[model samples]
Target: MSQIERGWDAIAQLDFDAALAIASRLLNNPHLDIRHQAYRMMGMANYRKRSVQQAIPYFEHAVQLVDNYKDRFSLCMCYALLGDMDRADRLFQNIDSLWGLPVECYVSIVMCYTEPKHFQRAVDLLEKIKLSYTLLGITDQTFLAIRGQLAFHYALDAVHYVLNMVSASFDTAKWIKSFAEEMDEEGKKSLALVSDQVCHTKGPFTINQPNSRLQYPLLCKIEDVSLFEEERILGIRVLYGKLHVG
Candidate 1:
């Protein structure tokens, strides 16, 4: 077998050191394609080895040689993994379309948002994924579970933002109600409890209410949100189960 094929074989076998060695040798090849492949192999090997920082330059080199979807996507993943959300977001935006990408690719993209608590973006992407699955007449239980997890996080984050007074105009109650509508029975119940708590504390006061007496109730709501810890734990357990199965 050629060295490139051998390098790929080594990567498949999880022998990252051997793959890196082979790829390193090919880096000086005369052909651009060969050099690009070498860089990609090295990047893949390092990434699989959990050497994410080491992987970036190789992926960057590959992209420099051939600025295609696959290389750019791989580089974007590296940036996301490194917690460089701005760079990753930029790369993701540059991609023309996610059509025809695998479900795992979509999941990875969602995770780029989800991991950094960018829950709204994660939820939006999940909605798009669901639409794509519907258009293609595809139904998968694993995807459904993943959707639920993402949705749960989105709801939780919305509540968190409201409780923290991060955004003045955020309609937490309205968002919770809308999210609850699409949830399963258990999910709906959980969100219902959260909604009730929010409403009870929120009372008749708007966030912009200048009344000091009303401010006390809003302050109390911050502590009230913690009362749903059991629900939060349950949701987390469900997420863990779904992720484990997937």
Candidate 2:
């Protein structure tokens, strides 16, 4: 087998030191792909070993070799692991793809921060991702998977935060209304029951605490979801009053 293949085999065998040793040789390979792969392999090996700072230069070199979304995504995760969330988010936003591994990469970063101190940050990050998917018309299965992951990792509190945000957001509320309207009476009833359960389940955490103070632009963007919902409800109320007068 080629040295690269052998190196990957070593990695698969959990011999990170062996893999890194092989990666060192491949880093100077004449072939560009081999060189890039060497850097990435070193990064992954170090990342698996929790040597985040050591992993970063390898990922950074990989990105320097090929600055694609996937490369940037790898670097983003590395930054997230290093607790440089702002850098990670900036890199993620630069990646314009709406689906595929990019979404998975972003979710991986959020999931990495599932400790109690960082859990709210993860939830907030998930919320922003949900907003993106909502705007992009992503699948219900995707949404369900994300919600399930939140519940699995952080329990009901995280799920309830998402649910409450959905309850308040016009786009998500419209999704619920449209979905219910498409169903039979029994299905509608079932949805209502579930919605009631979700909406009523209060999260243990506050929305905007000191540590979770959102930055501008994105903060405004997130608030726009609620504001849009409020405006839509007000419009409905005005129309109802006019109809009653007529």
Candidate 3:
């Protein structure tokens, strides 16, 4: 196998050290694509290892070599994880072909937005994704799976926003009420859709903990299915009570 192929294999095996070592060897290669791949692999290894700060420069170098949405997305994720929302937002704006990205990519972007309390942007992106899926005439089950994931995140974000607003002294009663209703609706939708056999039986429904890397709460699946369901119900109940009580 080629050095790049071997590097990827190492990454797949969770051997970040080996992958980084192989990638470093190819960084000085004459071919631009090879160098770009090396840098990309290095970045991915570091990112997967949760050394997000160390991953940024490698991803930046990879993107400089060849500007692609995948590398740019990785870079944006690193920035978002580091709480540099400004840089992440800039990279997000520059990403092209939003409709062409995979569902996981969309989920990651939504998480990035919600991480920084940019809940409105997350909602807007989901609306856009739904419109795209409709335009593309995607399969019903596939659409439902994507919708379920989006609803979960939306409900989760709503819960977060309501809690923050309630803790603050601001007069957020109207906004809290609005989000409470929205959260309940979305939470119900999420529970129904995610529980559908067709939605969680196959595809990316079975979550795997590859390593110590951070996993998004909404993306938990399979073994955590019951936990997810309970959380959804609890969030809705808690938010409703909070809004009604005071």
Give the candidate number with the greatest TM-score: 1
Candidate 1 ranges beyond 4 A from true positions: 97-103, 115-117, 135-137, 152-246
**10 residues in a row with least lDDT, candidate 2:** 237-246
* Model 2 residue-pair collision total: 0
For TM-score, candidate 1 versus 3, the one ahead is: 1
Would you estimate the TM-scores of all the predictions?
0.60, 0.53, 0.57
The TM-score measured for candidate 3 stands at: 0.57
CA lDDT, candidate 2, residue 119? 60
Cα lDDT, model 2, residue 224 = 13
**All candidates' lDDT scores?**
0.58, 0.55, 0.55
The window of 10 residues in a row where model 3 has the poorest summed lDDT is: 230-239
Q: For residues 150-240, what per-residue lDDT tens digits would candidate 1 score against the true structure?
A: 5454433244333443234545566556555555665565555446656555423323323211100000001111212111110111121
lDDT tens digits, residues 72-174, model 2?
A: 6667766765556677767766764533443445455554443346567666666667766777789655665555444434433344455543433335445
Better TM-score candidate (1, 2): 1
Q: List the pairs of residues colliding in candidate 3.
A: none
